[model samples]
Target: MSEETAARRQRPRTLRQRLQHFMRVRFWRMDIAADAWIAPTASLDRNWPRGIHVGENCVIDEWAIVLSHDYTRGLYRDTVIGPRSVIGTRAIVMPGVRIGADCRVEPGTVVSRDLVDGEHVAGHPARKVGSS
Candidate 1:
């Protein structure tokens, strides 16, 4: 067998070994606060903090991208997802956005600001569409 091939085979399994590899790779740096649930298929981007502070019982769905830094300007910030909140599939949470407890961010939503507790938001620039 070729030396290069043997070396490749001996390499450690990257955190991103699954179909949704980005999720696991990014999650390695996340804090993932107590009892928070993160789906295996979720795709968390690298423009996030070294650790994610997820409150208890938070459910981050598949393909959700939670960011803690603004890549455009090279500014870093922290993202806080409060307890019991649900982040829907493919939702994008921008840097420094604080999602309050029990909030619901719908699929395909782009959240760029703070969300109050129990708020139900949707759309590109997510707004308070209703109260949960």
Candidate 2:
């Protein structure tokens, strides 16, 4: 066995740490909070583990894409989806956007900027559509 692999196996681990490690290694780097659900058809960035954080009670629907890295300049930024937020089908949340709590992103929306709490948005460049 490789030395690094053997040493890693020999180290002790707490249950929580082990679980976190498993989740990071096995799933996409989206640090999804408990009770948050991402549909099976959704795609989240695996390249930047520390860049994605999804809060509790959030729902990311089918074919949604949550990106954290910009390939143009190879930039990395944190992306946050706050509690109780909903990202609808085919939505694309761009890198570095902070979506606040209780926000609703409509289908096929492209979120290119930050969204404040309680915002209901839609369209290509996701604009505020109605009162949240």
Candidate 3:
């Protein structure tokens, strides 16, 4: 590999740098708190640019999508994710959903409502399973 590619493999970019790059390249408008871990495959809604807020120490796993606009409902609202939480692989956070801190959303979940602090949920429509 070339020297630049080798250096890139040796040291991964910081979360801030990654976020900035995504904002620049993908044109996604999101407010991601420091220490957050957003997978490169995670998709944030770009149609509603200013409608996503992620708190510190959150993890958005691969293929996870955080949406902000509901075309079917003809609505647009903010989607919030936590100070400390994990959005599992392929999980979908629907428009306007608020995910509280210390929560864990298991894989393949479809969240349609607000999740309170310390809540752990899974499955379609995301029922409260237990505390995190």
**Candidate 2 local lDDT, residue 75:** 89
Tally clashing residue pairs in candidate 2. 0
Cα deviation in Å at residue 114, candidate 1? 0.3
Q: Write the per-residue lDDT of candidate 1 for residues 39-118, one digit (tens) a residue.
A: 66665555554635677767777789888776689878888899878888899988788999889898899999899999
lDDT of 3 by residue, 1-132 (tens): 224323433455567658654673456647887466777788888888689888876777779999999898899999999787888899999999999988889899999999999999999989888995
lDDT of model 3 at residue 40?
78
Top-scoring candidate (TM-score): 3
Q: List the residue pairs that clash in candidate 1.
A: 31-52
TM-score of each model, in listed order: 0.74, 0.79, 0.81
Q: Candidate order by lDDT, highest to lowest?
A: 3, 2, 1
Please give the range of 10 consecutive residues that has the lowest summed lDDT in model 3. Answer: 1-10
Clashing residue pairs, backbone N/CA/C < 3 A, model 2: none
The C-alpha stretches of model 2 lying farther than 4 A from their native spots are: 1-29
Cα lDDT over the full model 1: 0.73
Scored by CA lDDT, what does every candidate get? 0.73, 0.79, 0.81
In angstroms, give how far residue 46 of model 2 lies from its true place: 0.6
Q: Which should have the higher lDDT, number 2 or number 3? A: 3
